[model samples]
Target: MKTKERKQEDKINRDLAENIKQVKKVFQDCSDVIYREIQLSEHIQGLLVYIEGIIKVEDVQQHILRPLIEGLAQHPQADGEIYPLSFTRVSLSQAQSATDWPAVINGVLTANVAIFVEGMDEVLLFSVKGGSRRSVTEPQTEAVIRGPREGFTESLRINTALIRFKIKTEKLKLLDMVIGKVTKTDVALAYIEGLAEENLIADVKERLENIDIDGILESGYIEEWIEDNPSSPFPQMQYSERPDSVAAQLLEGRVAIFVDGTPFVLIAPVTLWQLLQASEDYYERFFISNMIRWIRFFFLFLALFLPSLYIAVTTFHQDMLPSTLILSIAASREAIPFPALVEAFIMEISFEALREAGIRLPKTVGQAVSILGALVIGQAAVQAGIVSAPMVIVVSLTGIASFTVPRFGLAVTVRMLRFPIMLLASAFGLFGIVIGAVWIVVHLTQLKSFGVPYMNGIAPYVPEDTKDIFSRVPMWKMKKRPSDASRANMQRIGKSRPLGSDSNEGW
Candidate 1:
């Protein structure tokens, strides 16, 4: 049997009264929506609908209501005017005829004013969006010493504009999409047309279309939904609050996902090495950036394996340390009651709790709590013979090392992996640590981001790309983009350096 077609299809009614009734019914319980009936003339009438806090009242008054009513009053009886609407008379940046009822409803909800004339079947949607939004300021998360201070704002349009501001080219395309069935949150997949892989962009679009969640309040929702390996501890995508960072990634043939109401924009096809590199790396000289990159890499390893290595060496391989160092460690632990593993766990857990407390509490007191809490707790634990002084120092150093990782997502992954590695170390000493590390490396090599290798240029060993991975080689030397993210037009810069500089003088 053929199913009956739905009677209530989204068709605009010709009669203004019917349109208003249907719109009111659709927005039945929505107190935020404002509906007003305007007298275009003595016999003619029009309906205006918009949300209260979102739409700009002045723009609606000047561009839509005033001009619309005044123009209609003068040309009440146009001889052959189609719909007798003066679309050009309005002062809006953009106006469109919304023939479908869903479009009109969406327009009103998304901070646009919808105007319906008495006889016209379509309503005019004016672009009068205005709302309370955070102004562009220095990004709190991705702060840099030398770079553009401006960051993305909560507004989706503003974020895209920021991107456009950085890359003023027609090739930088922003494909807009509305996800979140109930929320109808706006999302944009931004990429350079000639640089970003077409297949990669299509894959991102497919994954986003597949999401059927009720709402998406932040970009993290999309990140989790579309990530290549959800179960893996490593982040398959990277997020940055700084617009310059987004611009840099876009220039690298990567795609950026801009979610409405979030300053943090997500970048696809990220690697373990990319997370360790910082924005300041590009701003500083090559040698300085390379040194800092190495420092970050070293600390990243320390954050993940330092405590476990300490436990494994002290408990199973004491002879590995010098005589004086071993004796000093033994003296510190002489009064401690718990074993090395137990002591490590106790200190690690306490430190994590303090870190979380600091973040969750009020900013004014949070720093104090985390710092004072750690110092007081560490001293008390050492004096009380609960944990050794060396153990306390090891945990403290490990906590400090985690902060050196530039990307928060990678930092979190490293922090989570610490526990399992520590357990393995306690169980089988250095062998267990090596086994766990190998397992992680295997998982990362297998993971894919939109079909691109998650650890691209590293596990696959693209030697040409090593300059940017382990070290920030000079900008002039980085003439090509990453192989995985870009299929064509890989050349980013030419061999042009200052004439007097060593990079160009010999050539």
Candidate 2:
């Protein structure tokens, strides 16, 4: 049965009318598909098919239709040689010939004009790429004060070109493939040639090719499908909208996956440290960067453990606190009906809901609603004697600390794990928090991103990678790419100038 179906597959027919009939049948309900008939000469006719809004109408009018209409006086023979000879008179640079219906259909769908002629068994596809798309703008998610202002747009070629502008070298290889059975989304795997490991590239390629989804509308779809562990709450791959961030990752021997319609590109084999560091970290001075990085690390702990610690300390280990502070907290909670754990849950949940509402609301009102809502509700709750004042302060601090993490994905994971840690602390005090921390550490140590460890620099303990893991050292002192991802060619910098040297002595 499969053999018979293969043998009966549709091919381009020599009869122009029959081909048009088949194409119209396939696109029966698609009103956007436009079909135009052109008279080439007294004996032969041609059919032009393309989608309405995607193709450039001006190019089709000037380059294709005008040339063919004017060349009618030449009066060529109606042979296989005639179509090839006539196409030369046109000025379009990107053109290809397809012998089957599938290829022709795909070409027309992807911003190409398909030309069908009489007495020809193939269709000519001319690329006239144009459409209304979002222009390049600053990335709203990964905004920075000291970095490039331009962000990636939705167009795949434009995104790749942006990266190319940063890394101007032939060694930056972009391997393209089409995925999704219905959407046929264009995806490109980008990495530097000598920097990235051969096996790592092959593994990424194999994982992508193995996906058999119906459609991919965004990079997140690909992220969900090709990630190392779908069940893990921690993100194995980092997604960024900034071209400089993606280019930086590629230079570090990581693979960047670009999907057609999303501004965010997925970078594979990312470590926990990479997600914690922001693009501005590299752009700023090393001393300032190190200080800010240390502050971010301190707040990261607060974001995850502040609520749980408050519960554990107030409920089980009150003696650990200073007597005056403990007395103040006790006096504040005198009128509260709920226990410490229950009060913390109420405040945390309410705060999270307000934050989510702010995000989901319109931009003009979202920030106002989030800020005002937090203030109004916290004040009302305190006056109503529902939640203690200290609990409110802790929840507010936690929310603020969460914003400090550079990567939204990792921040979300930390937010999600907070509740369970709170529950653990309520049941078993500080020891419960210890258990949860140990479990998370174990998971991070064991998790792999495209065969590279999630905590590559810390758990595996590569001495060379430590310079940029916890604190980024000066750019001049860094002389090697990360060893975990780019084992083949590790050196990325040469000898640096001495600290006080005025002469141009080193690169």
Candidate 3:
């Protein structure tokens, strides 16, 4: 059965009737598939095959149909040979000829008009890539005050064009591939030919080619398949809706994976520092950027350990707090029946549920619902003596801190790791928190993203790369890309120059 099917798909039949029969059989019950027969001349006939709603109807009428009908009427073929319609008549730039049934079917499915001429064993494919897709708009998730407002859309070509607008150079290469057995989704791997490591690009391509899936509807599907460590809770590859963010990563010698039908593009060989940093960091002045980054760092810790710390301090080491503060906390919990651990768990779980609910609900009511729900539930829980007020405050702060982290993937990972740390604190107090932190650091050090260490510069202690890690130095001061991802052509900037002369300082 497989052999018969393969033989049928191997080549196109010279007989137009037989070819149409096979195509119609394959596309049977597919209402969107359109087949229109056109007489090229008195002796020659051709069939135009395409899928509706994907190809441009106006283009078909103006460029393909009308032009072919008029052009063929003017030049009658005496030899009865089919004229090359795609080369001589069609205005479309993207045109190809295929000699197999599978190629013709694939082209027709992917917004291309396939012309099957009578007595010819080849099909002419003209790309008319058109569909109603979401336009480029401000990214909903990764909004910035100082950077480019335009974000990637669901269209793959539009996303690539956006990146190309930022980095206008021939050296910026985008290698395209078709993945998924059924969907045949278009995926592009982008990188600078000289800046990105050759080995890294090869490895990424190999992993992507190895994907044996039926369909890839989103970038997340590719992310899961190509990442180095799937078991790690921490995201091995960072995904971003902002084209500026992806362009910045490319400039830093990292490669980006653009999957069709998703605004989020995945950046490979990501580090913990890259995930923590936002696109606006470079857009703003160094001083302000550094200040905001420090705040984000502080909140990152709070997001991970605030509830656990509260559980540990209240349950185990009450003496660690100031006497007055400890007394206030104890008094708040006096009316509460549950212990600190139980109280903390209840508040944390409720806050997470509310947050998820807010995200799942429509935008207009989502924020309102989450905010009101948290406030009402916290107040009622405190008044009802179910959870202490301090526990509520801690959970609220933790939730707020999670939002401060720029990347949603990293923020989610922090939120997930929070519960485990909280459980540890409940079991072993501060010691457990310390142990959890150590384990995380160890895992991070061992983790890799496309052969680059997840902790990269910090764990290995590369002095050159540290310039952008803990602090945001002036762009001129940094002369090289991160050492882990880019192996050659490391110098990205020239020597630093003073902005003003000492003599003109007064001015």
* Best first by lDDT, ranked: 2, 3, 1
At residue 256, candidate 2 shows an lDDT of 95
* Number of clashes found in candidate 2: 0
Q: What's model 2's TM-score?
A: 0.96
Model 3: per-residue Cα lDDT over 1-507, one tens digit each: 999888866899899999999999999999999999998777677899999999889998987888677754224358746445444567778999999877888999899999888788878898998878899999999888888899999999999999999999999999999999999999999999899988999999999999999999999999888888899999999899999899988988889999999999999889999999998999998889999999999999999999999999988999999999999999998988888878888888899999999999999999999999999999999899999888888888899999999988999999999999999999999999999999999999999988888888888889888988878787777778899878788888775567663553332
Question: Where does the lowest 10-residue lDDT sum fall in candidate 1?
Answer: 1-10
lDDT of 2 by residue, 1-507 (tens): 987776457678889999999999989999999999988777778899999998889999998889778764134656534645334577889989898898999999999999888878878899998878899999999988898999999999999999999999999999999999999999999999988889999999999999999999999998888898999999999999999999999988889999999999999888898889999998998889999999999999999999999999999999999999999999999999999999998998999999999999999999999999999999999999999999999999999999999999999999999999999999999999999999999999999998889998889999999999889887877889887778888888876656674552342
> What are the per-model C-alpha RMSD values against the true structure?
2.2, 2.4, 2.4
lDDT of each prediction vs. the true structure?
0.87, 0.90, 0.89
Which has the better lDDT: candidate 1, or candidate 2?
A: 2
Which residue ranges in model 1 land beyond 4 Å of their true spot? 1-9, 71-74, 78-82, 86-88, 502-507
- Candidate 1 overall lDDT versus native: 0.87
Residue pair clashes in candidate 2: none
User: lDDT of model 1 at residue 269?
Assistant: 80
What's the TM-score of each model vs. the native? 0.95, 0.96, 0.96
How far residue 484's Cα lies from its native spot in candidate 3, in Å, is: 1.7
What are the per-residue Cα lDDT tens digits for candidate 1 across 1-507?
A: 222233245667778888888888999999988888888766678888889989778888877778766754235345632443543477777777788877888888888888888777777888788977888888888878888899888999999999888899999999999999899999999999999888888999999999999999999999999998888878889999898899999998999999999998999888777877899999998889988888888999899999999999998999999999999999999988889999999999999999999999999999999999999999999989999999998999999999999999889889999999999999999999999999988888898877878778877889778878887666777778888778777888876775656746332
Model 3, residue 148: distance off in Å is 0.5
